[model samples]
Target chain A: MTDDVAVLGAGLHPWGKWGRGFVAYGTAAARAALLDAGVGWREVGSIVGAATVRGGYPGHVAGATFAKALGWQGARAASVYAACASGAQAINTARAQILAGIADVVLVVGADSAPRGFFRPADGDRPDDPDWLRFRVLGATNPTYFGLYARRRMAVHGDTADDFARVKVKNAAVGALNPNARYRKRLTVEEVEASAVVADPLRLLDICATSDGGAAVVLSSMEFARRHGAAAPVRIRSVSTVTPRFPNTVLDLPDIATDSAVAVEPSGETFRSSIARTAYEEAGIGPDDLSLAEVYDLSTALELQWYEDLGLCAEGEAAKLLRAGATTLGGRIPVNVSGGLSSFGEAVPAQAIAQVCELTWQLRGDAGDRQVAGARVGITANQGLFGHGSAVIAVR
Target chain B: MPRVLTPVVSGWFAGDGDDFHLVGTRCSACGSVFFPREDVFCRNPGCEGGDLTETPLSGTGRIWSYTDTRYQPPSPYVTSPELPWRPYALVAVELEAERIVVLGQAVPGVTVADLAVGMEMRVVPGVLHEDAHTTWTTWHWRPTGVAG
Candidate 1:
């Protein structure tokens, strides 16, 4: 197993359509995290910021923006963008710095004020960009892809809409307990069925909404943590930032096509599964070792997909596991105990970091009413557009 | 004069009716194929790399999956705010020979009810949007045996 980096603190700005700038949310989250860690901003040796688009050029330079907001003390900074996985990339960047001895303590931050309704590519005729081409040529949006996957699961695994609704019902109930969540009301299968169809076979309730939110974490070397008088802090064991192998067969988002598999056979593992696999391998643990998981539930049905991809169960058996209540609070391997993106919607750059925050809470027995009993190891799985894949494993 | 026929994004597809097909590039050494056509380099990592040649992909394939847009897409997709938005089915078709799944909008009136997984589909030209001086053209997927 890779050596662990101490998770000194984790925090978030409550998610919702707050109509604020990303800088405001990010600074709030960073300040909260710093307060929780009992560390002064001036003491931080480095910082990494997950980038968000649509805020002009400063959005791309997130690290500097947050540093300036926190009253920069010459902390080394870096900014990264990997679409949805941007938060995880930021965390990975901070963890790398801590492990590499470049910095004793590094602050990782991700925040976004998402645009309302369907997210579109930046204007201007850029034919070389695939994200632009998909919309310009086919009018395909993100929900459409979620719809296709939801339907395919129905055809392949007999996962009815009822099964999809159960995921929302379960997550919303949990989300209701977390103050950081946007939507807290319990939903019923009937309510899900009655919701308007945003994409074929998937209702509006099944899809996640866009919101303004931010999350941050403080990472430090094990020695630094001990010196700071915090003994047995939650430790991050693995951060999988992997890319898909060539000849990716399954069609993914922001692409008008899948890679042609003519030249080579497709890899056995889908990109999502490979993401979790790398984390499990690096942590020297397996699915059975996980006490809880926080996954990107972009849609309720997508949560079920992550189940099989994370190897919590065999392929096509996620629905069966869900029916058995094996992934709920008291089940064999409770998943998405944080209400997931279903409750939080999406704040783009902030999400993956938010997942780590959930893991920190659960592992430390600080998740309150939603906390898993005696929680230990936890994993978070998420994917970004254009082949960006991420997962993080934490244990205490 | 139809304001001069134009492919919305040029060189991605060409021709008319039965003669139409999507364009791509094939690597000479590894025989790897790229859709939306890769003119620069072969994407296969194992290969030492080879010349990418422009090639026409087969027009027919089976439906890998399908969904319909129930709401108007945001900008860059070009739906008029003035018109009541009509949802269109989007199909991912898997070409057996090329083994690539290409996504496209199903022809008008082709809803999710009319499409099924594994059903046959063929590529055809369709209008994306139009203006006083021009009609933006794009490819659409239609079930192989269906006709208006």
Candidate 2:
């Protein structure tokens, strides 16, 4: 017997700069999920929240706060904080609860109200924090990290600015059909090239913006699904939330240095590669089996990097893969069918769950216009600021 | 009078000129090295935890990658609003002996146009910013052949 939990419902609050509280977005998404699942609020035995650092007290006590917003019926609540991977962690927690028989049905919620401009660390003079030190010392914004990765890809793989622009063009075209996407207009490759550089080698269009948004999912045990009068429900096959192996040689975000590989040899797989590998192992599948993928394309070049890390292409061959039209909508294994972060921007806690929500819709044959034709298996990949690794594999 | 110097984060670097080095912690038992200096214990899981000793990282390393900020980064990274934001290059250098990557701002006057991947760059003393009395000193990376 396969260990599977059903994604009974998926819902979202449209992503954009909606000057409002995260609670409103989260509550609306939660209610929509509950309604779509045909499950009553009182029936939900558990709620797992992906927290936003903003929004005062409610943001801090996310799970309980959402429970209260939904007229609390005494649901067991938990909150997760894993930077960008918070949504996946929340979903994983709910899945664990279902698998353990602790709760037959659980609600997972993620929402964020991102501030304008570059995302900054909390106000402080704490030199102990690496996130703070990165800004204070290097003046490195998120785009600079993307720029470094983009430039490196160019040097090693011979990727060009034209290649980077194609990623944005493709994602933007697909995003035009996504109603929940913050940016619905199609982006031309030339337009992307014409945009001012936010970081050298990476233009403003090459990077995703910060946004306000929310996503919610109603997950239940396979047995609970059948009893609730649903058949052929989309199932979550795997959730990988792992830390980096020691001597993580790749320079990741918010860090000034990579682990020293001099002492011990670095693992063959970089941290990102390991994330997808772990999820594939748990799901008993490979990149060949994926009908679609939703990766954290914080930058167009980074999206190409994910292609290699997720095993869709060999290292230094990402640009070639793009040129072949293999990663587009009608390709053998399409990536970011939901338009990705290139469209929705980053809602931090919400984006990962939003990926799953897209997967759920596509699998159900309900993703109109942007549907991945005959999709059966989907995967999402994202990395948290620190060492947190996240990926999820879903299938029908 | 010589400008008073203060390191943005103390113990991260030391010395005035050619004697300079980035300070990291070396695991006495496993020989693992940590930058941004982890003093608690070795990060390597296989080796038994050992006392972390302060160690100097290699002065020169190959540029793993490099980039520059074209816009002013949001604060805590103090930059004056009145002044036109001058961009600075950032480099991730893969140290030779330590086999670790350390990121630092490229030395003043160095731009993204001047650097290439795998070029040798060495640690040097530089000023991050100056306000009234104190000059916030920070480490910088310069191409090996370039003079500070």
Candidate 3:
């Protein structure tokens, strides 16, 4: 296993449609993280910000913006944008700095103020851009893709719409306990079924909404953590940012077509499966060793997809595992104990970092009612636009 | 005024009726094909490089998956504000020979109920939107047995 960086602090700005600028939420979360870490902003050697495209210039150069907002201490700054995986990429950047001895302590932050309704491509008549082409030509929104996946699962795995609702039901039960979650009300299967259909086979409640929120984490080298008296802090074990192999068969977000597999034979492993496998391989652990998981439940059915992709269960058995209550809290390998995107909606850049924040809290035995009992090893799995694959493993 | 007809993005597809086909680029060295037509280079990692030639994609393929948009899409996807929103089906078709999945709107009147995974589908030309002076033409996927 690679050398670990200590997660000294984790914090968040509660998710919702607050309609405020992303900087405010990010700064608040950064201050909270710094307070939790007991580290002064001046003490941080570097800062990495997960960028938000909608935030304009400041959001694009988020690292500098956050650094300036936190009172410029001349800390080294960097910004990264990987769509939904932005947070994980920022965390990975911080970890890299720590491991490389470039920074003793690094502050990682991600936040977004999302637009209402379906996410659309930036304005303009740029036919060269695939994101624009898909929307302009086919009008296929995000939920359309989710519906496609949900329907595919139904046809291939015998999964029903009821099974999809059960996932939302399971997550809502736990999400109600998370103070940071935007949607706290527990939902029933009937409510899910009654919700308006945004796309066929997937209702509005089955899909995650776009929201404003922020998350931040403080990381330090093991030596720095020891020096700061955080001798046994929750540690980040692995951060997998692997890209898809050639001939990616699955149609991912913002793409109009899958890679042609005519020349190269399809890799037996799918992209999502490879995401977790790489994390497991790097962390020197397996799914069996995971005490809990936080997967990007973009849609309730997609959560089940992650369950199988994470190797928590055999192929075509995710729904069976969900039905058996193996993925709920107090079940075998509990997934999304943080309420997931179903509860938090999506703050784009902040979501993945928030996943890690959940892991840190759980591993530290500080997650309150949502805690997975005896949680020791936690993994977060998320995929972003284009070919970005994100997964992080944390252990106490 | 008489409206002109044009492909939304030219060079993606051509021809008429049963003779119509989507255009893509095939790598001479690796035999890999790219949709939306990759003109610059081959995407295969194994092969050093190859000449990408314009090739017509298969006229028929099986539906990999299907869904429909229930709500109106945002800007860039033009919809008449005066008319009530109408949902349309979308299908991702898997070409057997090239082994690629291409997505497009289903022919009007087809909905999610009529589609199933692995059902045979074929591409055909259709109108995407219309302005005072122009009609935007694009591709649509239809069940092979269905009449246009």
Chain A only TM-scores, each candidate in turn: 0.99, 0.99, 0.99
Write model 2 residue lDDT over A1-396, tens digit each, in one string. Answer: 239899999999999999998998999999989998999999999999999888777887789989999997999999999999999999999999999999999999999999999999899798998899999999888889999899998988899999999999989989998999999999888899999998889999999999999999999999999999989999999999999998898899999999999879987889999999999999999999999999999999999999999999899888889888888988878888788999999999999999999999999999999888999999999999998899999999
TM-score of 2: 0.99
Listed per prediction, chain B TM-scores read 0.96, 0.96, 0.97
State the TM-score, rounded to 2 decimals, of chain A in model 1: 0.99
Best by DockQ: 2
Alpha-carbon runs more than 4 Å astray in model 3:
none
Q: Write the per-residue lDDT of candidate 1 for residues A1-396, one digit (tens) a residue.
A: 778999998889999999999999999999999998999999999989999996778799999999999997999999999999999999999998888889999999999999889998998988888899888888789999999999889888889999999999999889899999999998888998899999988999999998899999999999999999889999999999999999899899988999999989987889999999999999999999999999989998999999999999999999999999999999999988888899999999999999999999888899999999999999999999999999999999
Q: Residue A271 in model 2: shift from native, Å?
A: 0.6
lDDT of 2: 0.93
Q: Regarding lDDT, does 2 or 3 come out ahead?
A: 3
Clashes of 1: 0
lDDT (10s digit) by residue, model 3, range A1-396 = 799999999989999999899999999999999998999999999999999999999999999999999999999999999988899999999999999999999999999999998999999899998889999999989899999899889989999999999999999999999999999999999999999989989999999999999999999999999999997999999999999999999999888899999889988999999999999999999999999999999999999999999999999999999999999999998999999999999999999999999999999999999989999999999999988999999999
User: What's the CA error at residue A358 for candidate 1, in Å?
Assistant: 0.6
Total clashing pairs for each candidate: 0, 0, 0
